[model samples]
Every structure is written in C-alpha cells, then in structure tokens.
Target: MTREARQEALERHGLVESGDGFTVTLKGFQKAAERARGLRAQGNQEAALMLALEPSDPVRWEYARCLQIDTFSTEAYESGF
Candidate 1:
C-alpha cells in the first residue's frame, strides 16, 4: 500500500501522528502486525515475522499485545508485547 494509505490505516485504527511525524501510533503498530501476518500467510514467514517483531510506540502497546496473543509463538509478540 501507498504511504498515504498506510497513514490512513493508522488513523482509522486510532493512531494519531505526532507533530514530528516520526512517532508510531496504535494503528501503525496494528498495521505492522497485520503486514507481518500477511507476509507469513503468503509463505514469506521470515519477512512476515520480522515485520511483526519491530519496535513500536507505547500507543501501539495494545495493538501489539493483541497481535502477540494471536500469533503466540511468533516473534511479533517479542517486539509488540
């Protein structure tokens, strides 16, 4: 997806972009988790898992938690949870 689309997704998922624009949101975290899962599902398990395991802001803590619970043994939980 385009950067705009990604930004919109983050907003839709309840993430607000900081004034500096570098901060990560709950939505962005969730999107990353989703991207990871999608990559895994497409047989790119390494990439998918990597995406999910990246660090995010506290705002995304909840989103990461959810992804962790869902993915369980995956590295997504390591970064997100």
Candidate 2:
C-alpha cells in the first residue's frame, strides 16, 4: 500500500490510540523497543508508527552497552522506587 493509504488507515484505526484521548504507554523502555521492532517487521511505516506505543525507535549506542547506568531518575526516585 502507498504511504498515504497507510496513513489514512491508521488515522481511522490505530493500535496505541483508539482515535480518542487514550494512549498506550509501555512499561520498561527496552521492552517497548522490542515491541516497536516487531511492529515494523510486520507492516508499513505509518501502521508501525501508530501501533508502536512510542513513535520513535529506541537508540542504544555501543558505548552505552559497556556502561552500568545508575544515574538517578527524578521520576523513578520520586515514586519511591
């Protein structure tokens, strides 16, 4: 299908949002990344974008993998996690 068709289809029926105020937010960044990868593998760009909880793909730098990230997150810390 063409890009426009995909976009229109998603606009009518999407995965994350039901065209309502509701939106999906996946727990755990890594897990959400995996889900996005799977969605892209299955279909067109617009569909994948609409379906994936996050519109953007996850980026993990090679250097990041080597480090043990223990930085304090205000969101996580504030939640008493």
Candidate 3:
C-alpha cells in the first residue's frame, strides 16, 4: 500500500503512530502485525495485508476474540451470527 493508504488503514484500525521509531502502542496493531508477519513468512503477503487492512473481516474479529475479553461481545455482533 502507498504511504497514504497505510496511514489511513492505521487510523481506520485505531492505531496511533506514537512511541520511539518503529514502535506502535496499540495492542490490536501489534497483534495484526505479528499475524501479518507470520502470513508473509508463509508466502501469503496478500492475505496478510488484507487481514491488516480489513477490520470487518471475520478473521480479524476472531483473532481479537483471543486477545481481549471486551472484544468478544463486539466481535459476536460484527460476525453477524
């Protein structure tokens, strides 16, 4: 993605570009980056990026389900049963 698109994606996902160089504070963004890195290592860069960019993806919601208790309720609703 272009720099503008990446910045927009970060904002859309509620990430703030704070902290020292290359560091991100948002837990969700950290998790997404980890997941994306793993996917990219496995040669699935497109899928990795999609997971990072698309907050509406069921996979993203599911991933969040494992990360935070508060996410469960919202993810359930977002998943549409």
Candidate 4:
C-alpha cells in the first residue's frame, strides 16, 4: 500500500500507535479477538449444520463432491458443461 493509504488507515482506525516499531493499541487487540471469536463461531455453526444433516442428504453428498462444492454441478453439468 502507498504511504498515504497506510497513514490514513492508521489514523482512521486508531488501532495502532505511531511510535517505535508501531505498537498495537488495546482496540487493535480487541478487534483481533472479536474477529477470532467470530471465525470460531462460524466454524462451530458449520460443524453443527454438517452433523445435523443426514448422511444421504443432497447437501452432505454435495459436500464431498468437488464439482458441487465449486460450482452449479447438478443443473449445469446436466445441461452439458
């Protein structure tokens, strides 16, 4: 990033103190913790959803299929691609 952009980000967020080697402020650490917590919550939700689905369910089946995971496999593949 350009120097101007970096300076702007630092000033706008107030997440770090402009000092010897750039120390992280409490707000910065809190933000990081919040992000980590959110990610963990999302992972747990995904795991619970996966576990709740029957093994024979289309979603479970699709989870193991690369084409299904990456794209519109069922209709698109049948339509010839």
Q: What TM-score would each prediction reach against the true structure?
A: 0.36, 0.25, 0.30, 0.36
lDDT of 2 at 56: 54
The digit string of per-residue lDDT tens for model 2 on 8-56 reads: 4333322122555323233223343454466568875743554433335
For each candidate, the alpha-carbon lDDT, in order, equals: 0.51, 0.35, 0.51, 0.42
Native-referenced Cα lDDT, model 2: 0.35
Query: Candidate 3's residue-wise lDDT over 1-81, tens digit each?
Result: 556755554454434454632223356555655656676789885646556556766666545433333333344346553
Q: Which ten residues in a row have the lowest lDDT in candidate 3?
A: 64-73
Candidate 1: the clashing residue pairs are none
Query: How do the candidates rank by lDDT, highest first?
Result: 1, 3, 4, 2
lDDT of 4 by residue, 1-81 (tens): 455655555443333434544443444433433443454577855535544566556554333232222222233345454
CA RMSD of all predictions: 12.0, 17.5, 14.2, 17.3
Error at 70, model 2, angstroms: 28
Q: Model 2: C-alpha RMSD to truth?
A: 17.5
Lowest summed lDDT window (length 10), candidate 4? 64-73
Itemize residue pairs with steric clashes in candidate 2. none
lDDT of 3 at 10: 49
Q: Which has the higher TM-score value, candidate number 3 or candidate number 4?
A: 4
Pairs with backbone N, CA or C atoms under 3 Å apart (clashes), candidate 3: none
